[model samples]
Target: MKMFWVLTLAGILVAGMGSRDGAVAQTRVPQKVMKYLESHSFQDLVRRYGNTTIELSVPSREARYLDSLPYRLEAGFRVQVVATTDKQNASNIYRQVKQLQLDSTYLVQEQGLFKVQVGNFTVRDSARKLLDQLYYAGFKDAWIAPATIHIAKKAKVLPTPSDSIYFAIQVMATHSRSKAEETAQTIRKKWNLPVRILAEGNLFKVLAGNFSEESMARQQLQYLREHGWPDAWLTQLLPN
Candidate 1:
């Protein structure tokens, strides 16, 4: 009777594993096992299994990948359009700045105020030019401010297999490497998706996801725009 019961249980397990819909399979699983599976992701399962059963020969690959990211900082200047304790006012000023179609713009929260700044310039004269433009544009209080900025480096685009293409959502771009990385981390933690920082010209772009379909990227872009990153937009990644 015990052997017969074991054979019947084996058959049930096999049937559950072969089901097309996971609902039927999950129904057959024990409550405890089902709960465990529900709580853990597929990546977690693979990581746990691999750590216990496999030996990684090259753990330094992870360190090398991190080291490949360029991180350089230097003294710079920025045109500060507005510094206000009122969040709504600061946001309104940011939109006004965007309307002027400046190259780079970002909001910095420092010392209990939101500062809307634009143009990452290596020299004060360049920043002063933007400040004058802001003044003429009705931002009379705009001034040049000294800031530490990220020195952008050319990003190496790795060739994709079979010349395949992908898309991503650019949530933010800034002259501060720390700010870009921080934003990337926040997005990753919130959405549980891959985030990358790419240097282009004089800015660090924070991009999220590697979606194969443009529709999927557009969906994610809409979601991000509705969320905290109101300026997020879709970008295509082509094979080199």
Candidate 2:
């Protein structure tokens, strides 16, 4: 009986191998025969387990942050300070900062290096004025230093004759001639208002502001009058 069973298993294994990839796959598999043939391989196994594959993908790397830096441009200037040969200059600056209420402070740059900075103002002209004033006020070492100003990214507000009084200043003419020059300088110096002078024929008309409301213009004019510039007045600059 053992010999008969052994012969039957061997016959099933041979039949399975022959019919693995053919129409004669109707071969009956006994449990022992199936286990014996399970470890064998065929063309499908060769295509799956022996096949090499390469994937197309992006390589892993540390992310770059260079593009995230700001493109905001700052017009730069430098400020000169007392060069500390010893502790004296730094001490003088520290003392004067308290005495004068200056909006600047000291920066410890490195070993044996210290910097006195005045302001981080948005206006370049203001910085220049501060430098000049400091120098003229006996701080000869005062000068401007080129520093990057982090200006907020925004759509630039342009200089135009804007009126809030429901009417715009319509200048029939403009010129940089002598009377026009005088009027501009006078307005800026006296009333803290920028002057724009216009010429129609031989007449030199100086207009100080653009306002949407006549009441606002009157208020500004009143302020100018209080400052003793009585000649300041308002009129419709709009062309008829």
Candidate 3:
């Protein structure tokens, strides 16, 4: 009788396991097992058996695949709306853009300048379209800037000596070391552009960017003027 009951119970459990929907089987449990379970509450059984914890394990194939992937860079074009020495102004402009439902707006501090920039575009044409939208929406100073945008970590690349022979925009100069650092920090934070402070005798000269050509520097100078650095001047950086 016990052997016969075991065969019947196995058949019922097999039917239950086969169903995708997992509806309870109409097959009834063996009377003896059902009676034993009915006498013991689920909580009581769990307390008696104690508990075990489980952690998910990664497959070796998946772990190796993830390790083999190469590091990728995500540098691209962006539309800069405004930059200012005042933090409050940057905050206000950022809020204004957000209110206009311009979702990609960002406020960054560089040297001493706080800038509100928008969008991650892979091409100049895409950034230009956003620039037109911003201008039409009353942000007349908006312009596109090509930059190295890091999604994960910044890429490490060694520059050749010849790379220093480029134009730069000198936005400010002062005798105070603190003042030079503050301004340079703001510019770097806002634009991700290179900023340098040269000790020109007593004065500390704060300069930004190393454009490969004079025209490129002039273009950036105009952009800086429209975006709040009106006194910006272009200077060539001779390779040392």
Candidate 1 structure quality by residue, lDDT tens digits, 93-205: 89988898765678889889999988556667655656777899999988888876544332222334557877888999999999999999998888877889999998999
Listed in order, each prediction's TM-score against the native is 0.38, 0.29, 0.34
lDDT of 3 at 182: 93
Q: What lDDT, from 0 to 1, does candidate 2 have?
A: 0.48
- Output the TM-score of candidate 3: 0.34
Better candidate number, 1 or 3, judged by lDDT: 1
State which candidate has the highest TM-score: 1
In model 3, the runs with Cα more than 4 Å from the true position are: 1-164
How far residue 142's Cα lies from its native spot in candidate 1, in Å, is: 0.6
Candidate 2 residue runs with Cα over 4 Å from true position: 1-75, 85-88, 110-112, 121-125, 148-240
**Would you list the C-alpha lDDT of every candidate in the order shown?**
0.67, 0.48, 0.64
- Candidate 1 stretches greater than 4 Å from native: 1-71, 157-240
Q: Which digits, one per residue and each the tens of the lDDT, describe model 2 over residues 49-149?
A: 34332222332232223223222435554354655546666777757754654433444343575656654444455467667767776778776776653
lDDT of 3 by residue, 132-179 (tens): 889999999889987543231221222426646767789887999999
Clashes of each: 0, 16, 16
Location of the lowest summed lDDT over 10 successive residues in candidate 3: 1-10
